[model samples]
Target: MGFWSTLFGGGSPQEKAARIAAKAEARAQREAEELAEKAAKTDGLFERALGKDPENCSYDARQKAAIKLVLANETAKGREAWLSISRDYPNELAHALEQVGVCYHLEKNYRAALENYEAAIRVGADAGHLADNMAEARKGMAAIG
Candidate 1:
């Protein structure tokens, strides 16, 4: 079962919160394990992807591996890589920016996330998701400010 399933399974109020925290811990452990696995393979596939034309060559697979690098590599490298994908591939820019937005949100930088999401919308991103994310971000911004 997924984290949400484990957390929200039938329970009393206190039991529910405990389950949620435990589920979060388990998910963190799983993510850490996956990050470790990706780090082991990064030296090869990650380097091979660098300086390569991702257009016809398929950036989809390459981009995913690069995303994993954010956890292992310094912030500059990950931001640089993401920026490259976004700039060089206008066709893929929206998604790339969306990914960056997610990275910022993960880091608790809501303003940056909203900015990136707005950029994605301006670039004709998946409209449905953009709208929903925009609403959520606005709610967050309102709450904080």
Candidate 2:
């Protein structure tokens, strides 16, 4: 049933449809305002899940921001996150070493990209994806320059 028909249909025929419409409109307005308020909230104040372990968490505000940035596909922000965490976390450092290659690749810096990719491998990244990435960077270096 239509919204108005559900609430106002059962009412007396004398019930003005205008009043029901006004009430619905007011309710919609209130809900919209509530959504807007929630959207305005700053996520900077919250810590999300831990990557390695749920109990292992990021207490650093910058790291938290970087996570949000990575989630949001902000590559520059992702790079910043890598920069901040690589210094502290060995795993993150290895990952960041790979990301350095990625950043260089994005900028078309083939030599730099290859160097970082190799460094990531040297740093103990044996992941198949890393191998594939290194190969791709090598191909790019050969083709582009």
Candidate 3:
């Protein structure tokens, strides 16, 4: 076999292709397994943060747990958690809406981010605090358009 052939596994064209394909499949499998493990770990952390009785937890505790998920880069999950909190705790609706807006912002859904941010302000979030974030969302929207 030539140097190239030997270096590339010393096989016929079809054999080399098969070897490459097998290697790619194995790599994909490994990646999938790693992702699954990571998801499990994240879920465990989320569950622990929420405690055994999430429904009985205070709004502050629930909000902290949701914020943890966002800090961990689980934006979608964090958004969902915040939305749930908003529904379950009317007193804290503005803050929860603001957090959901933040998650949408992180995900680059500028329109949704703006909508949520506005909703938060209307519901009682400090407009001064949310102004920068709303500006950023507007910038993102302008860029995409």
Candidate 4:
């Protein structure tokens, strides 16, 4: 019935395996819940995801929050978060700008999207695939006209 029983008792190996699996699943669930709770404690959604002390949160922390918000379809919020962080972390501006462009593009603000993508490239987010994203924004702008 318990770990001691599973380990020391004469239970079948299958039962022991199942118990171990259930315990592992429970532990994973508990850890996930704890992380979610920690992310929920801040004021706004972005802040909450970042933590209560965003000012002290690292660049990676802010980046993770932004990415999570975007993936969750809170793109506008994610863009805002990225923009806010970029001001303080100019070195990360290129990546943040690219994300902002993506948000604007999704919202059909094609011109803003194109501008941001261009800015991202200019600021050294100049990876080859970034060009593809910029081209998509350009296509969107053209389609609008």
Q: Per-candidate TM vs. native?
A: 0.54, 0.48, 0.70, 0.62
1 or 4, greater by TM-score: 4
- 1-51, model 3: which lDDT tens digit per residue? 889877767877899899899999999999999999988867864663444
Q: Write the per-residue lDDT of candidate 1 for residues 23-112, one digit (tens) a residue.
A: 999999999999888666665445533436345235765576557666665344555567777666668888878877767666666788
Clashes of each: 0, 0, 0, 0
C-alpha lDDT score of every prediction, in listed order: 0.70, 0.64, 0.85, 0.79
* Window of ten residues with lowest summed lDDT in model 3: 47-56
Query: In angstroms, how far off is 7's CA in candidate 2?
Result: 42
Question: Best candidate, TM-score-wise?
Answer: 3
Q: Decide which is better by lDDT, 3 or 4.
A: 3
Tell me the tens digit of each residue's lDDT in model 2 across 1-145: 6797887575655566777888999999999998776444323312222233345445354456555555554555456556656765766666677876776666667787778888887888666767777777788878876
Give the Cα error of residue 135 in candidate 4, in Å.
1.4
User: Candidate 1, clashing residue pairs?
Assistant: none
For model 4, give the 10-residue run with minimal summed lDDT: 41-50
- For model 2, what is the error of residue 17's alpha carbon versus the real structure, in angstroms, after optimal superposition? 44
Candidate 2 residue pairs in backbone clash: none
